[model samples]
Target chain A: MQGREILFIVLSLVACFAGLGVVLAKHPIKSALSLVVNMFSIAFLYFTLEANMLGITQIMVYVGAIMVLFLFVVMLLNIGSDRSGMKILDLKLVPAILIALLMFSLISFQVLYPLFGMQYPVADEGFGSPEAIGKSLFSQYVLPFEVASVLLLVGIVGAILLARRKA
Target chain B: MLEEFISNLHPVLAIFVRIICFSGIAIMFVPIQVWWERRLLGWMQDRVGPNRVGPFGLLQPVADAIKLFLKEDHVPSGVDKFIYYLAPILAFLPAFALGGTMPWAPAEGLYGLLTPVADINIGVLYVLAISSLGSYGVVLAGYAGNNKYSLLGGLRASAQLISYELAMTVSLAAIILVTGSLRMSEVVSYQTGPLWGIFPYIQNWNLLTPTGLVAGVIFFICAIAETNRAPFDLPEAESELIGGYHTEYSSFKFGLFFLSEYAARFVFSGVFATIFLGGYNMLPVRWDILAVDFPGWSEWFYFMHSANYWLSPVAFIAKCFLGFTVFVWVRATLPRLRYDQLMSIGWKSLLPAAVANFIVVAVWIMVTNLYGMIAGYASLVVSAIILLVLYLNIKAVGFNESTSTKRRIKMAKFNLKENEESN
Candidate 1:
């Protein structure tokens, strides 16, 4: 395999392990930190895909801002490691296992089916430039972009309303 | 032979050499900054600074480093061992990496060999992203120490960083709009243009323009807060939090924190210098323009212009040092702000002002693009007048409402007294 492919494989493995760490870690802070690792590895994956702008945005928005908030809340609450009294054979485990299997099968099918005759197109030189992204965002995808912005605005207003005092 | 060796070096080795040089110079500045701050602070407060050590205490930091290394590296009982070990590294790394995108000199010719380790397209945002990561170190340090004061310091740091980052990014967004690019080199080159696109004899430093001046001031304040310097140094407020996040840290870990803090200050000062103070140009004067405008002194002007071009690294370092001095001056001049005051400054004052400046820049750019320069100026004046009038009207209404409410409260009190008497 080429060096780039090797690098990609390594990054993907790291990302997968970090994702597992996020789920399996007992402490909430550990899980949050694992999620940060997962996010950073995914950003590197984006870099490998040559989507530089998207990769940067992923790091800046998710790992930098959102995960920081997750850590902030976790640290502020001072939560301890999970030590619940529930037994291993709880009824809830069955449904959770079923759902997990369902998700795994669905994702695997989509991945396996795509491997048969997939062909990827080469991206142009300016494919991931900020100017290119801006142009497409404002011109071609303006409607969806505006809708997403409005949704964010609604989210902000809702948050403020929920946090406001009764008076 | 040396030139040939450098030019023909492998790409990977070249990058390694460049990074080593960049980091070596940056780390070297920390000791000097430490000495400068102590001497300056002492002078300001009327006392002798570190004069007993080697030659005006120039070697004090080296002595301190040795002392810290020799001290016992103690860990408090009941602390999270993993994160406690990780915290100082996290704090130190991001601060060093923040300097990655800062251009020391023009990215051409011989001077381009060692500065700006990474000249990425998203330079400004990269800075923001890295600086945001710095708070994690403080927050994690606070949490891992398992001390009340450390936890409080961590909480404060996270909140403070989040609040100030908004204003910082917004103010920088105004500058981005003006420069029309996010690359650090582009931002610096934009400043090297004619002052306000009119004055040809002077370089267009961002501090000289109206909107740029406001944005620069806001960015400077936010940089101070981001670095956790005084008066915004709440995270490690010694009197209050007892060294804050590093309270339980000792020996080398604490020394790491100290090194990171000074390095961050030096880097942030360099960033400020690059963004606002005409990165590496010796003066705000365009010597080339002088050469063109004056034929009699053209030979002397040409010589000076070439000197300015070649000696840019010195100029850049000088600017960074000047900016560092200002940081110290402000630290000495201002008192630690109360928590509420700090929050209010970030949210109410800096954020709003930055947003207003952003809008002004946007409007100016749009108007200038559509109409000509004269029309842009006219639109600016008209908009300013309209905004002023709107502000006055709002103030008047608020004043009337407040007075009426007060009078009503007085009347209600009087009525209650009369009712009691009748009963």
Candidate 2:
């Protein structure tokens, strides 16, 4: 009815379609690109929700950096050859379909059923600011924060070792 | 008429005017930048440059654009039709949009926005997001062109991003820590004082601080890489790739890539100037401070005191041009780096250095603020010792030196012992 709501709906549809495109696209690169689109639309959704910091972070980390790396790997591998050998009746499809159905039902029952058609509340002051996040992260979630960083450092070291051992 | 224009200008109308003016400034400067780089490069290399086309080849870019316009646009047989057409635009748009967050000038008087356009809280994040998105243009162009050279160039460009961007962001994080804000205007304003808290005599440009200087150097190197400038320009090493990502493009599409490269260079220079050098401020001291502390000298140095009022845009442009000249100078002076060396510097040296310097600065800030001068000095001494140790180790060993292929020497005693054990 209103302009903001209309805009929200449009972005939601874009996110949904891009999400579907990620799963349905034949080429891995195309799927990766669709995932990128989905990420950007989610960032826009964050913007509409007035979580400016979160929205920018989503774009900065996911769409800009992470997805670029994803696409780079995709391009480097040059997987242009179509690998659509599996038919609809393939046994591999059954487990995947069953898992998808379980996820759908679980999400629908737990989240969608309870929260359906409810208007989202506006964010409070400094809800998604760097200061807000930093304070909480340092105070309440310090263990998790430090652990995550250490984990990342380990991964980086492992990557260097893997590369260096070859040389 | 002027009064009427200012009397009740609507917000939307003002924004439109500002957008038009911003874009107009950028568009007009592209040719000038191209011409300036050409002439400067010529001067450095001892040649006349493009003096034949127009007055000092001022109109050379215009001629080139027209020629490109008239040239036949060709599409090769193997290229992806849709993506090939779409690639140029993706390459072009991001460069233009990258200039959005920069505070070129204040919006006092008849100018539109009071702060910079898009002065959102997450100014730095917005900039990082948009500039990082620039790699897409290269990747798409290289892939769509369906040429091996183009694809290699594109892949190199993305790989380059993965190496350099982490260091770049870490260096900027140091600056943000020092400033306590991410806004460009805030960063600039913070620089408009002493070099550090203690040094009242020196301008407080971030370049003067110990950790800040290290961060500044790292930031500039990363900027050079981000813009894909020489000597870090492995993506478009012409001798190797034969025009690189735009190898398959012809006519105006090729022109677009050329244009975007220069524009992005200029914008990145603006960003560097803003973050490190003090955006539009010509000097560190404020007018009020000068007038109060030494009124007689203030009259003689009116230009220093009054740069912030009306000359911000001019100051911004001059700084950008100076930065651009440096970019050109480096291009003329340095050879293109080998790809392995490029990666080595980005990951091993710059990244580690940036991370170390950032932690040192953060500790420096915390110590200096909470405790007395003694604590601050102690922290400084500790960091300096650590730096010295690291430097000595690096000197003693080597950078990215691998030694797996060296021949192994057998010890005589160990060999005899092993023979006895076997027997």
Candidate 3:
């Protein structure tokens, strides 16, 4: 493999391990942190694909803002050290595991089926450059972008309403 | 020698350059800032600080580092051991990562041999994102500790950060509107010329311009509050909450908390410099002058052509130091605001002000382009009047007097009942 490829492989391995750590770790905060590592690795992958803006945005939005909020909620609730771990597992583990596995299989089937016959389109220029993304976002995806903002606004209103104490 | 090394081993050497540059700044600044703070505090308090540590306390930070390293590390029982350890790393990482985006100085010389670290285009956004992530460490520490005070501190921090985050965002939006870009470098460049006001004869730099000065001042104050600096530092208030969130921490873990605090200060200062002080632009009119007299010098002008290439890091660091000085100065002078006052300031005062500022700046920009003159001074006058009126109203009403009287009466009744029982 080329040096760049080798480096990529190493990073991918680290990312996968970190992701596994996120799931396997007992503490919720640690799991969240591992998820941050996973986000970072994904960001690196984005970087490798020359999606510079996407990579930074991924870190900024997911690893930074979302995860901080997640950590905040986790800390606020103080849910980590309770002896209710076994009880929680007993209540939800079997169903959750089954649903997760079924979902995973469905996704895998869809992905694999697509890969077998469909040829990936090759762009004349690089696929994931900032220019390409910007073009797509402004042109074909403009409606979706505006829609996302509305969705975010709705989410914000819903959150405020939920948090508000009834007078 | 550097050219030879760069040519011989470009890729591997580039990675090394990034690592060295980022780590060097982070590692060196931690100690230097510690010492600077100590000396500054000493000067302020009329006392010699750390004079015994070595050469008028020049080596005091080094001594402190050694002491921290040698100290016994402790982990309290029932704590999430992994997260407890990981929290500090989380705290310190954002500071380092956020430094990636700040354009310290102009790219200098041909081939640009001296960029500090990552010079991404979305530099401002990246810094904001990374700095916001810093809340995680404190939150994680508090949760992992499984202590009530720590949890309270964590909750307060999260709320405080989230609340101020709106004001901060709004403030940044005003700047972005003025600069017409999200890129830190571009923003700095826009501010490098004298801002022409409504009057044709009157022009000044943004710092000197009325609206710009107000925006800069608002941003600076917001930065201080956002960083949880004193007067707004209710999260880790020492007197009330006993060291606040990281109270259970000791040894290197505690050191990490301290490191993150200083590093965040440094990073925010860099941000302030990028946004307000014109990044690595030495003077407001330098670019204009470079274009006019000795136009060839434009090629060699470090602040203009080669910022974010060579001198960017140095300029960035110098700006960061200036920021640190401001933080330290504020810490020395300002008294910590009461918790209720802190909340009111964030929600009622700053939030409204930021929103107003954003609107005014946006309208001003639009109006200036359309009408050839901005009504910014009018907007400023209106905002000032509204603020003054609000302040007066708040002073007039005061706290809930009825509730206070009721509580006092209840306390008296309880004392009388206790006396009767004793008799």
**What is each predicted model's overall lDDT from 0 to 1?**
0.88, 0.82, 0.73
Ranking by DockQ: 2, 1, 3
Q: What's the TM-score of every candidate structure? A: 0.92, 0.90, 0.80
Error of 2 at A59 (Å): 1.7
Compose the digit string of candidate 2's lDDT tens values, residues B201-232: 45678877777889989988998998899998
Residue B146's lDDT in candidate 1 = 94
Interface RMSD of 3: 2.1
Superposed model 3: Cα runs more than 4 Å off: A2-25, A48-51, A81-110, A116-154, A164-167, B197-206, B287-316, B373-423
Best by TM-score: 1
lDDT by residue for model 1 (B60-126), tens: 8788889988999999999988889989998999888898888887777665766678788879888
Better of 1 and 2 by DockQ: 2
CAPRI verdict on model 2? medium
* Fraction of native Cα contacts reproduced by each candidate: 0.49, 0.78, 0.62
- lDDT ranking, high to low: 1, 2, 3
Rank by TM-score (best first): 1, 2, 3
lDDT of 3 by residue, B1-423 (tens): 775665466766775776566667777788889999999988998888778877878898888878987888888898878777877887778767766756565544422344446556666667767767777777777776767888777777877777777677777777777776667657766766555533321224456665566667777777787677887888788888787788989878888888888877887887788787777654454543554566676566535544434455566677779888989898999899988888888888777777777766766666667665535456556666776687677766665666788899999999999999999
lDDT at residue B338 of model 1 (Cα atoms): 100
* Interface DockQ of each model: 0.66, 0.70, 0.50
